[model samples]
Target: MKPRLGVPSDLEAVTSAVIRTMPLDPQWDYRFPYRHQYPADHYKFTRMLFEYFLDPSFDDWLVMVAEDSLAPGDSISVVSFGVFDISYVNKRRHGPGYKPQDPVTEVENRGGKTRRDANHKHFNEFWKGQIRAYKKYFAPLGPEQMHLQILGTLPEFQRRGHASSICRWAMDHVLRKSLKDMSVMASPMGYNLYTVLGFERVGTFYIQVPGEDERLVLQAMMYKPKIWETKTTEDGDGACVML
Candidate 1:
């Protein structure tokens, strides 16, 4: 079966997986430094963000989850997930179901506005750095490229080859569209997996909070297809679109 489509139910599980992955990732800390100080707000906004991804009305975005067919007991079934965003969707290729547009620039204000401007100041600054990086390397995403925006597998599921399932789906998706490259901003924790999936670093970017020792750094990677023709793999239900 194909990877399950991400649904509303998967939101809680996916968010948990992401939170678990945060210790190994700085990207999360970059946007959500106040998570510890504002746990309620953190989860509230995160669910909202993923909810947007799962919304069918949102165009040119794909979010999928992988199930653990053998979770035994109460272990979560949806274990791994991937999120993708296309800069430009080809009407002729994807049909009229998608929204055709150029890459966008928007910042999510985790900062509480007037009540929490301080919480979001660094958030905005971090996003500015991210926007600058994208503008420099892959702004105005074209039909020739697709972006692997986010990929996550629970820590307990790591080394189980779950991530490859998502990567395969993405590669196949790109090849079907005949797109030339797949782009991603990979964190240190994900470098190995992306490397294994044929991604190569073309550039790097970072952001650091002024009064804190914390920093966020990522490598801009593009997938180089080893073969124009897609290859089949034993996906083992690593990722399936939610029903």
Candidate 2:
């Protein structure tokens, strides 16, 4: 199945697919520490995240979804999804319609703090720390570089080339726009895949929660546009280099 540019209407389906696929990575599982105890809150946070990505007002980001036709009807299944942030120069910019204050206030306005509220607070701190570390250790290639924020394929759809298709789509867009490179924070499971696509590991980081036993490890990877190499091979023919 081919991947297509996603629209606001695809928000719910894409969010569900993301939540389903993300746990396949140990890092995501460790970061979303409350998933088992508070499934509803986990879903809510995931939905809000995708809503921010899909908001039409946010032109600096692009979302692509891979789908499978289930029948003769128009129904389809989302097999994989990817979100790319197009502006490396505006590195600190947030999605247009996403107001971090609103969510924080909303949670506080509920009077007493619930488990969900605590989870939100913990996750925010964790996310902020990761961003700070990223900024400290990794600098953008240039104004023309792009960031791959998230990419995942449903477990059932793994090895089907869904994720690769979306990745190639982003690379093609980068080439057309004359962008210099692309970067991503890759989980151990995805490290090999990104390496095969020509992304090199620049650094690694580990995220550990105060009371948690599991620590999440991630690799920072950067990919430069290699149009000449891509042109000589069939799409999605890149080799995976296991580390």
Q: Largest TM-score belongs to which candidate?
A: 1
lDDT, candidate 2, at 48 = 70
Model 2, C-alpha of 58: deviation from truth (Å)? 1.9
Q: Write the per-residue lDDT of candidate 2 for residues 1-243, one digit (tens) a residue.
A: 778988889988998898888887775654566677778877776677677677766666678999975355867788799988765434436443333222333433443144452344445545665676557545534355777888998886788798898998888777777777788888888899999887899888766667866566778788777654332235656653323
Which parts of model 1 are misplaced by more than 4 Å?
A: 69-76, 90-118, 209-214, 226-243
RMSD of 2: 7.2
Error of 1 at 163 (Å): 1.6
* Whole-model lDDT values for every prediction: 0.70, 0.71
**Stretch of 10 with least lDDT, candidate 1:** 102-111
Candidate 1 lDDT by residue in tens digits, 79-196: 7889887645755567646455322221144433422212465666676776688777775554567788788887787777777888888887777777777888888888988888
lDDT of 1: 0.70
